[model samples]
Target chain A: MTDGLPMRVTATGLPARVRIHEVGARDGLQNEKSVVPTEVKAEFIHRLAGAGLTTVEATSFVHPKWVPQLADAEALFPMLRDLGGEAHLPVLVPNARGLDRALALGARRIAVFGSATETFANRNLNRTVDESLAMFEPVVARARQDEVHVRGYLSMCFGDPWEGAVPVSQVVRVAKALVELGCDELSLGDTIGVATPGHVLALLTALNEAGVPTSAIGVHFHDTYGQALSNTLAALQHGVTTVDASAGGLGGCPYAKSATGNLATEDLVWMLDGLGIETGVDLGRLTATSAWMAERLGRPSPSRTVRALSHKES
Target chain B: MTDGLPMRVTATGLPARVRIHEVGARDGLQNEKSVVPTEVKAEFIHRLAGAGLTTVEATSFVHPKWVPQLADAEALFPMLRDLGGEAHLPVLVPNARGLDRALALGARRIAVFGSATETFANRNLNRTVDESLAMFEPVVARARQDEVHVRGYLSMCFGDPWEGAVPVSQVVRVAKALVELGCDELSLGDTIGVATPGHVLALLTALNEAGVPTSAIGVHFHDTYGQALSNTLAALQHGVTTVDASAGGLGGCPYAKSATGNLATEDLVWMLDGLGIETGVDLGRLTATSAWMAERLGRPSPSRTVRALSHKES
Candidate 1:
């Protein structure tokens, strides 16, 4: 309870350590209506790395026209060169061109986004599911050739806003394809946040059956329906170690003003810390960093843990 | 995805059906800074029952001096008499006087609140833990004599704000004392919202080893740190059937302006519905009810489900 920490009480059948794939700099800020200054984004990532987050997603290399909020990806990536830690800066590469741009700047880790369902694939990437996979094929191959750590982000793994229930087999097929295409890890995303614990376990079970090891899989859950933490717990129960969360739950849902987007990193840390799972992240520093970011965002943080901890400090 | 419903996918070894103990009318509003009118309170309860919640805690019969927000309990109980349904209206009775008042109003069910830690017991009840338990003994005895159902609410069962990391043994001692005093059910409360899934499972396991059956246990979790739903999932995994929640997350925390209170009913329903567990509650109707209450409270609901579903409607 001192410094807003939960008492450690380890559970059976869970990984001892979880690597938090901090997505605040990329996934979080991308959804912001206003563009954050490139320096601020760099400082945010630096703060995240300083708080002990090893893998901090820097920014997306998608076209500036599509995501103006992260238009300074070229400028922002260079500022993080002095982050000075064992932190891995992973940037999202949309295609071969994006990958080329990321590689020119010495990016060591890259992630390719794909959709599990055709409807989402068409909506998000403006291509069919197969077409999106085809696009990622060359990019992933190129990244693997250069010894880059490639993470395949499969969106709408459980339920789609348009397609409703996504078949587990469909997700497995794409996930297997991503791994086959030389991706080192796959991050399963509940895009609309419509998944439950059973669905989470079912999907993970299906992926394992399809030859994907638990160690190579991560989970990206949104808190749109407040299922993120519970779903994360279910994922942990299934031996998945990497969890994607936004610092201060930075990505607010674009569809609704009140709807939450990504799962808050602080909230995830609270659960992990309480369960005796180490994420190497400092809770107090992370909360302070998120609070600082929220102030910059001109809004209060959507993270319950951040708010609770910051309120205590105040 | 129509009407904002999650696709059903069942998890193994979970209860086929869960009975939701709706506490919005009592525990939720009791923490409100301003008192809601008696008519509005009665209407809210009716709406909740209409939405298929079987057990709705109506109000607390504690002295008005302590809880002025629910002081209209005397005026509210009679208004619910005309509520035609299978719904059970339970009320909190602080002492013998409160029990007499509820019994006179023909209350069929009553709950006595006790604190597991001596600090909380002394602060909340103005007596030692043993002394508070002794006070509840007569009230529980009297209620049982009248063939009334009794629920013992053990607050700060997980962690206390003043005394951090409450021991599992200490909670078990108070819980056993409550059962020995003739309580029919025990609601273990995470009053400070500091519990993780492992802590939840550990406590449940310890309670079971101490002779408290899962059948007689319920979980009441607060969302101060966003662990309520995850903790509830852990409790459900341990075979707990009754889960407590507040409609629209009605109880905002008194300690912090940004701190959330109860596990939101909408959020819980979203998880249970997706798990394919029968709760007999309509998600659409329940969301509408909570939204209506939130309007009356003049604040947006803290429930992620409520916001997501209500946003879809707008």
Candidate 2:
């Protein structure tokens, strides 16, 4: 209660420790209306690492025209070079050209975003699902040959805005394809945030049956319907070790102002900390870092933990 | 994706149906800054019942000086008389005087609010925990003699603002006392919203071990830290079938504007609907009701499902 921490009470059938893949810098910022300066973005990543997040997503190497918010990825990546010793800085690469730019800058880990649904794949990447997967094949192969770790992000794994509920078989096929692409890990994304516990477990079970081990899986849930933490709990119960969350619940849907985006890192930490699952992050410090970023964004944080803790501090 | 419904995938070991105790009119409106008109309050309760909420808490018979928001409880209670056939309109009775006021108005069901922590008992009721329990003893005795259903609410069961991490034994003792007071049901409240899934399960398990059946208990979770749904899921897994929620996530902490209040009914429905659990409520209709209430309150609803679904409707 002193630092807004929950009482630690471990649950059964959960992972002993979870690796938090912090995505506030890249995934969180990409959807922002205003572009953040390069220096501030670097500082945000550093603060996240300082708060004990071992894996901090840095920036995207996509064309600036597509995502102007992260156009300073080249300049920002250098400022984060010192943090390599403290955390894993993974940048997003869209294709072979993006991978070339990232490798030129000595990026050691990278992620390629794919979609489980054709509608989302076509809308987000301007290609069919198979076409997008084919495009990522070469990028993933080159990254593997360079000995760089590759994380494949499968978006819209649960429901699509245009396509309704995506079939589990469709998701399993796409997930297996990503695994076969030599990716070190696959992060299943509930892009529209409509997933629930049973659906989450069903998807994980299907992916496992399709030869994708739970150890190779991660979960990225949006809190759009306030189901992110519950879904995360389901995935953790299924033996998932990696969980992706944004610091301070940073992202908002570009189309819907009231719609929330990724699950807040502080909220996730509260649950993990209460479950007595080690994530190595200092919650108080992480909350402070989020408060600082919220100030720069000139808006209040969407995270309930961040709001509650910062309100207490004030 | 249509109407913001999640994919229905039934989870194992969960109850087939959950009865939501809608508290927007009583618990939610009590915390608002401005008092809503009595007619609007009546319409809100009627709309909740129309949306298939079988148990809608109407209003509190507490001293108006303490909660001026519900000062027109006498007027509001009469307007809800016609809803008796559609829903259980349980009013809150603080003491013998409140019980008298409610019974005179033909109320058939009532609830008495207590606290698991001594500090909250002293501050809220201006008496020791035992003193408050003694006060409710006669009121509950009279109600039971009159054949009126009674519910006892035990607040701060998980964590307290003044006393952190309340002992499970302490909550169990208080809960048992309430049940012994002839109350038909007991609601365990996470007053500060600091509870997590493990703590939730632990408390439920302890209460059962203390001879309190899961069917006789309900969970009232605040979304102050965004743990409500996950905590509710844990309770459901423990076989708890009753959940307390506010329409449109009403009620903000009076002391902290940014802190959320009770768990939103829409958010709860989204999860239950996705889990293939029956709640007998029409989600689309329920969301519309919340949106209407938010307009009356002059603010956006805090419920993620309401926001997501209403945004699409517009």
Candidate 3:
């Protein structure tokens, strides 16, 4: 296995091994109208880790008023921690208060999210762009002091629902700020899933030129427009080693009315396996996990891989 | 606009423009369990042409005993000819009898189907690989003599359900025979939707090295495992300008149990538009057309673009 180098490019021009940052428990469940029980959420994470995901975003520390679906984060985090696996359970922290709650629960890694566009920042984070960055600054600083790894998420990096197509320079400036503020990794998110491979290549190339190492870059894509896999390929070709995916293709953007599911972990794993890239994930286990979760959700998984495999199995 | 010259490669290593050969009416509806009315089928072609699709495959001349869905090809072809748009209505011709029926209906363009793998050739065409090629020889020669354009379809070029992962050399041999037999173009079919981008690049590279022009290669992909668009991107990067897509993501291989819909035309058009590639299809009308057809079929369109646009409009 290759070390977690910032820019590990293989002979085939892709990462030798990719870290799939599982967000199904956090991002995927948060978007659902039906609130999942805390126990079910914990089991989903356990199953995901059992499927070989090293990094699992367990829960978010947002206020219940904002995200009632994840209101059981406090109850869920300790259960996930008690499972005692090698997986990194990262929690989403909106500000210092959320970080403090996560710290009290012994979260070793936490993520802070900001928006690339002002409208999204105001709507999602309830603050101006400067205010949102200011909000995360102390949380990131405190996490660094406590030896906690911080991952930063920049949403709408390609296009915004209100602001339309975002400039690459705008994304680069905010990404640089997050790195300077002690974020160990930054995820460029297509929140509305409007990105194509050309936009992905252009943005990642510009970010590299602006001094953000590709190794510290992860891509979080939604499959609303069916471009996630193609966009992920572009990211890998540019030497980005971390990718964010949701099991059973869970999650949808609340701001973008037309957006659908996140890039399915099973679909991503299938492509990586086909390309002969190492992901340390078992496709059969992942497929079974998604199928199990899909039954709990009382609906079929939107992932083509999950559907194809499930249909084949049945 | 670039000429349809064989082997045209732009500086960006992509074709300047792609010719979308719409296969909705024939290959798409042919697999449906419910028979589409001839009038609705006629309207679908009219709407597709109005949306600026230059080459639309109308219906197949295969005997209704084999494909009852396209039983009205005789009635359908005459109606399509009376509509009289710039679209080329290429009907599938199974053999000399099918070709004779198409000729009697004044069909100017037709496509013959073959198989790359031996088992698939025997199972689908009821002949061995050599026997299948021999069966198409006289049909292609006669079509060429009548000044009618002919396209050849090579199924299981990437993978066969019966005999897994067909070799690239086998596909090249079959493709070369079609071209030598006066087929104007060859559409390589991933009948099982198991192809990844790496396989696509390798196969296309082998074919080009084998003296087949890139311009004459069209990719027909299924979205079963969500690899169609990614494969299409790889094909375009290799300078292949022709793509086969189905409106509303219609079509499945009745022989292959797991294969799903063909790559949706609207989805392909969205990516092409985003990449700044010129495809003369109108996105709005195409969405409307798919939505209208979906209503007639009593289901929502399987196309992500059509769904997204319809959702946004509603």
Candidate 4:
């Protein structure tokens, strides 16, 4: 239970309520070394939504050749259709083909992936930034026509493994293009987790100046460099309401060797709970869900909240 | 290298410079599972100073029966006496006996420990809060008479394991007593690592209002709940300049089973480096020193910055 202290430190500019876009079932399991069973994935999603997460990234509708881990997306999405009627079950769509497959499965929400740096775009997507944007243009247009909600993921927004620190202007350019092309929301991602709070402020300011409103933005940070929570806090102070996190600390950057995973949803909830920021998520249930998943993964969850909560329970 | 953008967002009230009091050699190794050899401990301290940390907490002079890991304090203090001329090598002295032990070796800087919760003080030090404060009175007084600098550590300032959430008024009372007893600096410690940024702001505000100058206050946080850096950021934004961090994220909490060690120096340096706030800590060298220590500990350094930097080098 939170003490219900003064929630908004008005001078600090932190938000009153934060939207946590849970990415465990999609972005998290997709990076696992082993393929999670379709039933296990569905159960994981069910448990997440049961924990009061309003938005859970369900699966990726990508080509199986590219990501074998998420090859069960077609099966996964259909099985999760009955859970959490109001929950946003956004699936990652690489192109028009992926979008079509997601639509075929009756997915109402989908996401397109883009990258800020040319090197990451070329290597990860086998296309230049312009080519990648071109590929997503048709998918976004069709999604808009279908009256489906679409989220755009801009990766390498902070730094590229090969190109080093990316300029704020470059991230802004990609973010603007995604929004212009018809994304309902854009999730700026630090794929390598080299971001700090100041960098988050700089990039967000640049994006805001470029005319992409902060209301349409969410932050996705990896915990690879342990800057994710601080970066998320900065985004909150910057008035960005939505944040992307994974349950049980489930994913790692496939691009950055030895990198950790996304910011843990439980850890994020701990901070939000302490700040008295409304997230509509149950910390106890979330911790239990992560603990269950961690037992299945045969390792301890890296989420500090999950670890602490589980220890308390034990 | 920082991009050198506007370092201080004037409205945020963050300090232009932060003083990092390195606590790895003392707080860190004291909780280590294995006893570090005296020469290795000296090298660790030397390497920390070489990494540009000007205030490395060297060792503790507590009774060996209480903290057997720091039994070699006499040998360690003399060994590191000539390493860094400008660095303040502060040692932790529990009472007059420990103070006499440290003073015998010409220790110039020493710290006295106190607790905000009566339960922790009684359990950890075998004295109630008032009794502990009474015990430290003569010690702090004698240290002041010797013209040696003294720091007071107020543990459980936010929460205690036995007592759920510590009253802010209780923490302020203990803090005021320590300052009135002639402590040169007071380090407010989140012993259980349960503090969030909001809690940090509330506690700091209460302390400031109770006549403890923000300038004389330092924050010591553990990453048990992964809230250390975020809490530290909040403290910075609230105008506190001094922070305590451990190298390689060494030292698990002997009390809190699930708690990690102190906030890692490398991680703190990474954030400061990005914020363009001056800490004078060499990120690369700090990472290297942690890596070296982690080798001796038979594990990889838990500091995310250390892991990321070492991976980059490899």
In model 3, what is chain B's TM-score?
Answer: 0.95
The residue pairs in collision within model 3 are A6-A215
Predicted candidate 1 versus true structure: per-residue lDDT over A1-314, tens digit per residue: 24334778999999999999999988898888888898888889999999999999999899998889988989889898886357999999999999999999999999999988887788778999899989998999889899999999998888776667788898999999999999999999887888999989998998898899999999999999899999999999999999999999988545323335799999999999999898899888999999999999999998999888878768
The per-model DockQ list reads 0.67, 0.66, 0.33, 0.46
The sequence of per-residue lDDT tens digits that candidate 4 reaches over residues B65-115 is: 778889999888888878648689999999899999999999989999898
Q: What is the TM-score of chain B in candidate 2?
A: 0.97
Clashing residue pairs in candidate 2 are none
lDDT of 1 by residue, B147-241 (tens): 99999999888777777788899999999999999999999988878899999999999999999999999999989889999999989998999
- TM value for model 4: 0.96
lDDT by residue (B33-99, candidate 2, tens digit) is: 8889998999999899999999999999999999999899998898887887889999999999999
Query: Once all C-alphas are superposed, what RMSD does model 1 give against the true structure?
Result: 1.7
lDDT of 3: 0.86
Off by over 4 Å in 3: A1-11, A82-85, B1-11, B82-85
Q: Which candidate is the best by TM-score?
A: 2
Tens-place lDDT digits, model 3, residues A1-314: 11110111122576778999999999988988998888899889998999888999999998888899988988999898655557999999998889889999999999999999999888898898888889999999999999999999999888776777788789999999999989999999998777877788888888889888898999999887778887798788778889999988988877666557799998888778777788888888988999999899999999998898888778
**Higher-scoring candidate on lDDT, 2 or 3:** 2
TM-score of chain A for the candidates in order shown: 0.96, 0.97, 0.95, 0.95
